[model samples]
Target chain A: MLRVVKPRNARSKRALDAREPKEIEDARIAIFVKGTHTGEVVNNVMKDLMALKRPDAISFSKKNVIHPFDESSPTSGSSSIQSLEFWSAKNDASLFAIGQSTKKRPNGLTFVRMYDGKVLDMVEVGIENFVSMNDIKSAKSTPGHKPLMHFASELFDTHPRFIQLKSMLMSFFNGEEVESICLAGIEHVISVSCAPTPVTLNTASTSADTATSLPKVYIRAYTTKLLSSGTRIPRVELVNMGPSIDLVLRRHRDPDSEMLKQAMRRPKLKKTDVEKGLGKKRKNFEVDEMGDLRGRVHVGKQDLDKLQTRKMKGLKGGAFDGETEEERPTKRIKTS
Target chain B: MDVSSILASHNAKYQLVTVEKETPIEVDAGFLTVTDANSIDEDTFNSNIEEHLQSLARDGVQTLLAKLFSLPTLPSSDGPLAQLPPPTTQLPRSKPLPKIKPLTKWEQFAKAKGIQKKRKDKKVWDEEGQEWVNRWGKDGKNKQVEVQWATEIKLHAAEDHDPRKAARDARKARVVKNEKQRFANTAWAQRAVEAREQRKTEIQRTLAQSRLSTASMGNFDKKLEGEKKLRGIKRKFEPTERSVEQEAKASLALLSRMESDSKKMRKNPTSEKSVLNVRKAVRFASKGEGGVALGRKTAGEKSKKGGKK
Candidate 1:
């Protein structure tokens, strides 16, 4: 469940990252089949978020409350990130957002992937279902049926790399547990055969060609205890895959505070227009970390709504800090 | 680096859980750490060091004093038992054993103190019923240990420096005993008696409570799953088995129906109609839900109707 707090100056255009506004107005709430893995739903929601973009400048300050905790919000960071720190929110506070609130508990959807036969399917379990009274939680997951189905469908919509990755995973988990799908378990996998570009394909419901887009990848798991570490290597039939579909795990050094302070240094850009600026890189990211979201410079949710369809800029198949733009708006196909 | 041994180690006690060959199983069990659950389950859990202890005891390892709460009383010492030393060291140094005599009260009391009487103090007066005492170390010979007879006695030191009397004088002074000797003293007997009595009292109390609580236990046991479902019912809390219950209890009374009785209800359609009518026609839905079909069985009606039943 995604909720956008409307800047109280809803009608007026002011710098968002400027000294904290008195009260934020015009909060927009968009419900994604909350945790549904429908690519169309994600694309629509992403487009709505892109429309919310507004390039407002922010001055570097020790007091710049990037995300100050507000007590009035009922969901006040109980289930989401909370801290008075500057980097508490993502790099794009004035830039694009996937709808995060500093004062509200984020309604997150957990996606699980497990193999139903050789096909990788996904299931979703709502955050409400989990037992948590705090913002930070630790979980060791064992994939069951429902969570896997939601995971596969969301992988199809939000991430194209997941296409090949999911297939490779399905073959590995044909009848096994999904938590073991992490790289540590596969002790003997050689390199993936080929690198495929990240392609974002949008499909309307009930289209035959689009339905078979998710093809199965084949793999086998075997163990040689005599050889040591209960390691199982799955032999997967590899294909041309994208530049490590796992970019979420990449790490880089980005002066995010400087970037926001630099944006603040300029006269606030009017709410009507937002210029694309290079986001600072992150310092370090492990290969298995949940991807560097710094360059996730989305055009904010409100402004994206004003832009023309397919013209909303930025998200594409590329690595972070890469200068070139293969700016094809996400590959979207429609059905009658 | 040493792959062969690491690969070879398997928690054999967990034979039920087949270990995949390549998984690294740490065989660190020695004198510490036994985490494999099945090892404790089947009683085969022996650290290599513990196994060595068993073998050491089995091979008649002695001069090694192992403390036992109580040992079997026998005149012979064998194996571990053979390492025990003779009981009396500070008593009379008697080469000749004393002839058994019917002990009078005073003699018995002095003997109970672990003390022996002196040997050489014969009366100078002839055959006039005078008492005699031998001085210490000469086997306490010919000494009758009685305080009443002491008035009729004459005393003297005997051949062996009268060490028994010397030891008695030493004990009379508050001489503290060392660890081994103090532990062998009779004071520990009181502690053993108290521990035994405490356990007996506890057992008696437990048996009485079990007798008194049997009715509550039966009611709880009879209601079993139904009681479990009703717990926290007032709190809007969802029971873990809620999904299974909703699916299985479609039209059955919870009182006698087994949890998976959905099939039986599914086989017949009459129960569904009766449940539906009872739900719609009754004000006492709670009672109707329990399956007594007494027009919702209001409290007044239940009392009157229950009396007859």
Candidate 2:
């Protein structure tokens, strides 16, 4: 059993921030930005936003995500299409990005094309739809009833200024890079869905144009239930189907300095290969063994020519080896 | 309504059954949670049945008690009775409740503002003066004076590491290294020197030998009779190219000496006693022979001449 509490008075809050209403046919002004931001620019923009919202309503919450990867979507299979139809019954918001192409969806969602600065895009996905839709009776968490959805595991880091943050994209995108938030619309389709919940606007000086024409929506999508042990975890995540800024931050994890200290290592070469690389130039030597030293030794050209007169080295037996005329050796460094 | 067919299929999820040899048994866990269906294992089945029977037994006992007393039996463990403490007895009444004091506007505002004084002194006048002054003075303009005064702490200057001794050591090093460098050039220098001396002496010796030999051959008079060519144009003894090349070797030797001395003195000036001694001698000579502004002892005559040189 769930107890539904009536929303409290937030007139004091709505005066703070109000986005352009999806139901409105026109907007007072639509500001578009070209690129993402650097830290300084984000800081300045956040300061401007804070200044603009100082007088009226705003939302404040602190939460720690323990299991951020737990999420699901409907695009993985057709089994969950019925559940999506049921979802349309309760939630009038336009959440469906693609379809089987019915009168309801001829061209699918043109969400990316319609983005402007004033029209903010954000994504939130969670667990619940996978288990059951409490408002509906026939639906239940079963394998064939509502399937898992797989969204890309890419980064979602934008509007760091708005949230007082710095996304990982800061390394690639300069202050001038185009920025986009994955805008999964949780929108209304008149008879098929209900009005989307508007947040408590931050306290700021808001105009009547905001109150009459805008909606402050928290765009989110959720899974039907947790996966059974029999199910294999997808190579891609089946639960988180939309852009998650927080998840992007979680993926950008860093190791501590202790890890770097652990990495202090030395490079070593194998001693066994040194000799193989050096071959027989390293052969050892012996003393002289030839009959005469002058036969193999070299002198100046003139001296060699006049060797007979110079009497440089006599062809004496074993002269190089210090042997007497008795011993004669072959194959030595010298010649007779 | 004979809905057994429908119920049977729904119960398939929660059911525990022995399959016939001919067929496979597939029961979906979602349709039959362990909570509602018979446990697949004997231990769970016995435990769950035991727990359920115990609650029913307790209910039956309470119902009988209710009939006898004409009042509601103690609610079964299945209800609120399960949450209540053991029937030892109810707690007895004690002291009366105290009143919560409502704070005055002055107290509430002071609490909310979160002001902390240097000490917890309770002076009304002091609070009034300090609180009012601070509240009115919170605009950005008043913070400037405090910020300006706070920013007076200056950074200290960095210590300088003097490399003068290193330079001197490098200079002394050049002298020592020059000796090795000179050794390297010696081989080529010796060869060049030998070649030149041999060529020079051979020219003079060969001419003398040729004249003496001619006399012995009895052709000296004939050979020297009128040969002005030999006297006028004996291949003029221009220094050989090898000698010029040797000059390079010598210069290289000198350069390396200077380089070594410069290197040694640069590496360690004070540690090099020789360089220090030489520097001292040079400074002494410069001081003495460059002429003293003050009167000095005169062992310096030689130094003055060397200084001039």
- Per-prediction TM-score: 0.13, 0.13
Model 2 agreement with the true structure over A84-199: per-residue lDDT tens digits: 33322222221221111123222111110111211112222111112112322332222111111111100111122212111111110111111111111111000000011123
For model 1, residues A137-181, the per-residue Cα lDDT tens digits are 322122221111101123322343443343322222221211112
TM-score of 1: 0.13
Q: How do the residues B45-127 of candidate 2 rate in per-residue lDDT, one tens digit apiece?
A: 24663233222222222222122223222454343221111111111111111223344444556789985435533322224
Please report how far candidate 1 places residue B184 from its true position, in Å. Answer: 28
**Fold similarity of candidate 2's chain A to the true chain A, as a TM-score:** 0.14
* Candidate 2: regions farther than 4 A off: A1-108, A113-149, A152-336, B1-309
lDDT of 2 at B300: 68
Give, for candidate 1 chain A, the lowest lDDT window spanning 10 residues.
Answer: A242-251
